[model samples]
Target: MADIAQEAGFRKNQKLKDALLQHKALSRQGFSERLFGLLFSGLVYPQIWEDPEVDMIAMELSDQHSIVTIGSGGCNMLAYLSRSPKKIDVVDLNPHHVALNRLKLAAFRHLPGHGDVVRHFGMDGIRTNSKSYDAFIAPNLDAATRAYWDKRSIAGRRRIEVFDRNIYKTGLLGRFIGAGHLIARLHGIDLTQMAEAKSLREQRQFFDARIAPLFDRPLIRWITSRKSSLFGLGIPPQQYDELASLASDGSIAPVLRQRLEKLACHFPLRDNYFAWQAFARRYPKPEEGTLPTYLKAENYRAIRDNAERVTVHHASFTELLAQKAAGSVDRYVLLDAQDWMNDEQLNDVWSEITRTAAPGARVIFRTAAEKSVLDGRLSPALLDQWSYLEERSSELNLEDRSAIYGGFHIYVKKA
Candidate 1:
């Protein structure tokens, strides 16, 4: 087995390494944290929660720009490639994520056509995925990544076999979503039916009649109270604490309810694949106009041609930024990773960010709280070197179709 530590990408930085260990140790507290840790240690997000379309608009990428981003499920990074940036360096602490990203990159490059790509990733119930993997994706993967997917489980099937079944229903987040469907079923709410709603009015009505009622259930409230239940959402304990602090009465259920409302009712169900995945556990059928930019038929060729521009790294953002020469990077996508950082870790990360950012460098990230974390956490001197695009950030935050995060922020390095 690949050493989880090395794959975690923390060993390069002593501070980050220490922070990771501390979180792991603290996760031993009780059944909740332990279970959360176990879930987090594996693939947490089957797809990224943050909207890459919002990110692409916010980043304003060009061939002159070099971008670095956190690779969660590798979806957004692949989506970002559609913009044809100079290069995209995708960093992730999870080896599974790293492997997943590499697999996606290879799939885009080696898959025969857009239909095949769609078949491999977009739809489920395909019996040819394993054969497709062996024929196309496997040869392109590095040995470590290949071994990770090739490893057999107790069921006597290689882990990659999941793609043949339903990749969307396989990861920690996937199963968590599946469990949610079960709960919805128990309450007589058909989440799949929500996907078929015709309009926002219909969506809201369905949410109110069928889905919203489940939020009031005693079991859901009890489950949401525990930090462990959110592991499937890819929320770490530290992030849970931040979310709880923002929530009234220190209960996360209300916050989750509000977010779910936005996800289900705020956007047209036909166009919002994020909501579809949450409610239905998969993207809309290929016939539906809604799909991630990377998956759309029109962008496939561009993504395939530019797929080589993405390089996956098993490292922290700071570690990757430290390796780049000063002012070499023009765009940075942090996701919600700062929510997991301590002040020291944040400083370390932003320090490298400032050091490597180009003249017009823009950094974009999401947070569990509705405000940017940089204001109170980082040193004023360091923070002052970058200008917060407050109005633009707020506008983009509103434009974020994902509707899961509390805030979207953008900062540009000052001239």
Candidate 2:
């Protein structure tokens, strides 16, 4: 574990090392930019970093063309299908994500039907809802996933037991919130009630009065900005460039605080489901507000049937691009995967994207910083082919529910 942690960029800080060794600290919150990709390749993440809704908005996809995207947790790919795309390809390096995607598909196809499937996945992940899991999902899982469910944790808890235990509450993002929970606890603020706040004004007051000050503390800022700290969040060595681009000097925690503050203060807690998922561990009830369309029970069949357009690949974006015809894909969604690539890898990806694009083919992606990845990365020849929809991207960005990514850029493939 020490080697694993250090390989992920954890410096040999005695306090952190001791904590990590004892299982008391589980995050690599402030790891440096260079070490992230190596650390995260297949070890920790079950999902990708960018939000899928944002990708769909930026891509402006149509059913006329095929869609290619990183699978991540496979959430957004399914979310994309909700738009009626002709086809969708979901690719990832992680087997865990592949397995999870299959699980979602199985539930969609076999569960006691749509509403039950929605309740199982999109609900609060609690509330004693064992009907769908037992009646349909558990019996339909593939052999490997079934075996995974059969295993037990070190504490002797069955893997499937996570449904009741709320695995939804402990993903990469979930763990980040858990860290914030610990930090908030240290400051004597019980954030769970922030969800009950009625208006943005009250929300702002809470952030200004309670959360903002946490960033001002020297110890907290120093610890959080360090490269060694972010590992606990499960960001791999390759993806650090995306995170570093979020701030000018490459500080992470301050931006994190700002985003969480925005999530809590920019919208009423009752209407913000992402905030509810993070802080309150529940979805907003229908009487309170709305959820993502994919979260609704009615969308299950479309999601399950659309699995044909969705293909999961154990490959990189560039590798898949090689198979696509020139100007073939009408829309492409690269979910910040380029940030994990070195110079050579990035060039290969963009060159292929440029080659395969049709006159109206649109390529969309999010980066860690406010600027586009093509700025200093792609060559002039390759970059000049597409029309940059900066203004349009920004307009669509306002509607994106996934508030995590930095900037959305859409490029129309040159005719």
Candidate 3:
């Protein structure tokens, strides 16, 4: 049976709305924000965009660390589990994300093995996943999380049925990628061809011949101009502004093209699962390519064993940190979420982070632009307590396989 109180609390999306609604209700920006909140209230990222491998290096994760992070898709949390962290408190404003994290945790704890785990998360269109959920995963889930999956979506199927098809192909990000594929198909270009490239040169040749031309089309530029156009990429109105500013001519097309170039040509397709997701829309077979840290076969047992150390909270990071003891957290992972925050919100989060950070704590985050969002935004008093790793951040930003973010940043608490 569902815990009525827990279910009710999780169902309310007002906290998400409050965080996103920054302008007057009648304003265009306000409408866009609210619309994003609506779409985002459901699933957003099927997989988190930030590179956890880079994160592990930046934070220097060890068995001694206790991490508190914004749980976008729960991939990072589970990936961190492979490090055997002492504890990880995963907080998110979206109830659906909270449910998803809990579901993954339950899967790790109760599923038969790595193969079953992959069947549930890695591959797509496996109808038996619902059965697996019923027999193993569901029984282990909390009342609220169990009720969430059992509930029917608008499609008149249980939310758990997402695994029955392609779980990775169902979220807002998934639908956005699907739309991109549709748009490309209409242009006579199969974006998936990038996945077939045998080498970097081949990848660049395909991008130049097929992909680069589309960005220059009048229709493409026109569509990318609208703020609403990027809602699918999970770029809120504010972050859209930050991203648009990166283009010299104030067109997002060039910026997007540059990012896509990195995804297509910067790394070998066989090793970059992020590239697989962007071009192939699915992870490659085990023999064909790599996977996220948490999904890899070698890390499965460690993740499953450490699964009990994570606690998922459906609340803002700041709110969760407020309830924790001062100096309790050793690491923080904020994944481009600060790009959506106003100055006050930034300061509020930083205040909590500074107050709760343990000695020698490290924080890693990404941004839509090429500099720390904290500069000229967060209070100097709060910001001064941390030393920004500008050089290391620049190197890691280039190394991040996701290729979407403009910058990856790390800040260490002053000893």
Best by lDDT: 3
What does candidate 1 score in Cα RMSD to the true structure? 3.0
Task: Arrange candidates by lDDT, descending.
Answer: 3, 1, 2
Please tell me which model should have the higher TM-score, number 1 or number 3: 3
lDDT of each: 0.83, 0.65, 0.89
Per-candidate TM vs. native? 0.93, 0.83, 0.96
Off by over 4 Å in 2: 1-52, 125-131, 232-253
Residue 360 of model 1: what lDDT? 88
lDDT of residue 166 for candidate 2: 58
Over 51-151, each residue of candidate 1 has an lDDT whose tens digit, in order, gives: 88899889987778899999988889888877788899999877678889898888999888888888888888889999999998899888998998898
Q: Which regions in candidate 3 have their CA more than 4 angstroms from the true location?
A: 1-12
Model 2 per-residue lDDT tens digits across residues 1-415? 4346434433433322321231123344322433443344322433344556667667776667788787766667777777778877777655556666766667667766666655666665465545556667778776787775666666776555555655556545556667767877887878777766677888788778877887777767777766656665564444444676666765677777766676667666665667676667656777766665566656666777775666676666777889988877778888766655556667888888888777788888876556677787788888888789889878766555446656677888767
TM-score of 3: 0.96
**Highest TM-score model number:** 3
Global lDDT of model 2: 0.65
